[model samples]
Target: MGRLGRQDVAIPDRPSVGYSLLNMAPKHVVVIIPVFRDYDRARQTVAAILRCSVPSPFSVRVHVVDDGSGDGTAERLSEQFGGRIEIIGLPENLGRSAARNAGATNISADLLLFVDADCEPSDDRFLAAHLLSIREADVSMGVVEGQDDGFWHAYQQAARVRRDRLARRTFVAHFTTQNVMIDARLFNSVGGFDEAFKGYGFEDRDLAIRLARAGARFTIAPGARVIHRDTLDLAQVCRKMGEAGATTSQIFASRYPFEYRTLGYEAIDGQRHPWRGVLAKLLWPVFQPWTQHDAWLQWRLVPFKLRAGIVRIMVAVSYLRGTLRRHR
Candidate 1:
């Protein structure tokens, strides 16, 4: 590990190399995809990354780290891609962070692009864009466009965008394990991802916070886009949200005392608010431009009846849980 220094680093707007796709080959760039047991989507994600037209003159290797998926993920990956991709199958499921850490440790590449198993790049230039953007920052994050979740998903996504825009702080709105690349050394310097987060939620944001504190610069690559399929039912979504909330509370309380309230347990102030603080949370919705955008998005793209039913059930469960927690 290199000596840790804290300084504000500015990333250049453009890469040092010219815009020629043919002569841009950088062997130091490695793409890391961490997947957990979703056979079809995982394989397809791998294929998408492999087939992406990288304009950089770099030899990119795709490493797929499996987090003890019980499904036939290993068999399918091995059978399909064979020796073309590197597969690291862990003994147990350790969430997305640990899986990516395992993959990162396996390669000596200077740059590591991490994409989720369910996200596919819009085009081949995604990897190249990531590489080019690395000239100025330690990490580069791309945008996600939802695929099948329909209106509610779009609404949720818009809510996310609005939240990001409202933060006004140097926080990221879409810091998923999908469509991001980081400098291998800098990532490890901050101890990589926190393994305590077992399922989905907040781990990426947590890492980003730590990175910023550690003075790691990040660039948002607007051009590199990915199509994500977040098709979980409403019940499942609520469950995941609850898990994320609980785990995030624990992490913030333990590591960042001042920042814990920002994790959603308290308001921007130091005081802990009542459980019925939904009004405060939702009050600024109109100020968020994505709210209006999502309104149109939801109207135009409502999901099927079955999916809508699932969302209704999920919303009911979330409301009940909130009420019960407050009473307790």
Candidate 2:
């Protein structure tokens, strides 16, 4: 490990890189993990990454962008890691998009791997798989195994199975920032993430759509996997989902109206589904309690299928209500 260093960085207005699909051999890969006050997890991930084994002809540097933790977490990480990883401490809480954009300052890096702070690489091959995947695709999205419960746990875990592990380079439509790698040039060509996304939610999806539009190919790098440590209850999930719906849902819709409709956002936020919002409000009492552990409708009593359905409805209601509240 080298001596501790703090990197002060700035992104210029509308910077573009000349991207080449032919040269997929990466000489340098900068793993950017944007974190907000997640010190323990960040340290663990960075340490694990530094320990990982990589293929020859390519080197890995971990870049951590502290997004307004304001808690000296970045400095602490710098102290612990020394010069093994680069740490950028932003003065204030910039949204996720801006924080990630800040970490994309390594102009010499051929690949920029964005891994959420809460995740840890699954094996030694984690970095190698991502490096290998981009040889055939523009963006290499990693797989994940998680310790979670309730709907989100099931949903995230299910995401891993959606693409067969056998299909290493299986093309995927959806994208998330949790564990994904993209060509540095291609990411910059699309202006990186749209900082307009204030909170969480569609920022990753927004970037994915832009990347797709720019002819960026996506693949599922099965061997490149991580252990996602996020675990939240129904209410917590609702809160985050609602935050997304309230903050970035409309931004996404206004920017991509056709995608908004095609994605089923039209049904709830659309003119046709006004009654669904009202219905959700009317039934809020019955289902809202379910968010609490001791709610009348206990998950233990209810059948698995019905319980899943109820949980799904509760979340949808929270999200839709949030989107509707924007208009009010």
Candidate 3:
């Protein structure tokens, strides 16, 4: 019935950080979802989590942080879930990392599960899987499956392959915040997510690097899966890829220089194949004729693989351009 903002909630003091699981109880879990403007998707994600039947040993609490959506997101969610879920509304858009940190700070639970508003749990056993996995591992990173098989979907699938390959050798290589369960103490100790990443990328990997440095062991919870309901068309994908490049140049490259190299910026260098950047840049002029503009390019004509390859080159050029811009 009432709206809750950032200043309204208080984060309790935490105990000293330690690696031993015995020091903390893992029964109490708080699932934090940070939403920005996407009201319908957030509602579905919350509904799916509530539908989950977590066993008695585990008590679950759901908290939705509306990051200044200004789209009646808080009102809609409150009307739907009411007292069942706690909603925290910020005065302005604080980005995903800051929003999640704010939600984490407000709850005093043994385990903190961070799930994006765009993701829906695959099954009712979603929380159960993370719970079971955390018994043996400190931080459990779950799987994210794309709901559609579009260009962005194919790109995500390929990226997942690389991530999976890396995950086999070590847990520190790739960390996505989409569906992850982490110990509250460990999360708080590592200072949650780096708020400096004010945009749409790399905050999770930055947190992973810090968590690894803090001796937190990361493991895959294959059973805990979430369906990514949000799909990006080619234009949206390009914009996101550009954002990724910009973030890497501004934050990761300077903050975590060693880990930045692992991102493989060189593999997709458009400078080597000049035409890649030239052609991608040409999209602006090529699509200008269409009144609907970017929307007109959404039609899937080329093979997904070929489109993905071209998009990758465009993303690479965007990244390099972003890096250069930051330096300037």
TM-score of each: 0.74, 0.85, 0.84
Model 3 accuracy (lDDT, Cα): 0.73
Evaluation by TM-score, superior candidate among 1 and 3? 3
Per-model lDDT: 0.63, 0.73, 0.73
Clashing pairs in 1: 11-136, 24-56, 24-57, 25-56, 25-57, 25-58, 26-57, 26-58, 53-124
Per-residue alpha-carbon lDDT of model 3 for 50-96, expressed as tens digits? Answer: 99989767899999999999989999999999999999999999899
Candidate 2 wrongly placed segments (more than 4 Å): 1-24, 148-152, 159-173, 270-272, 294-301
lDDT of 2: 0.73
Clashing pairs in 2: none
Off by over 4 Å in 1: 1-26, 257-328
Q: Candidate 2: deviation at residue 65, Å?
A: 0.7
lDDT of 2 by residue, 13-60 (tens): 121232443455668889999999999998888887888888888898
Candidate 2, which ten residues in sequence have the lowest lDDT sum?
1-10
What TM-score does structure 2 among the candidates reach?
0.85
Q: What is the per-residue lDDT of model 1 for residues 1-328, given as tens digits with 9 covering 90 to 100? A: 1112222212223323232222323357777888887878888888888887766346778888888997878878989999999888899888788898899884677777888888888887888777777665667788777775666565556556665753443244445568888766667777988887665566786786666665555667877888886564444555554455444545544565444443343332112344434443453333234322323334434444544454443443343333333312
Looking at model 3, report the run of 10 residues with the lowest lDDT sum: 1-10
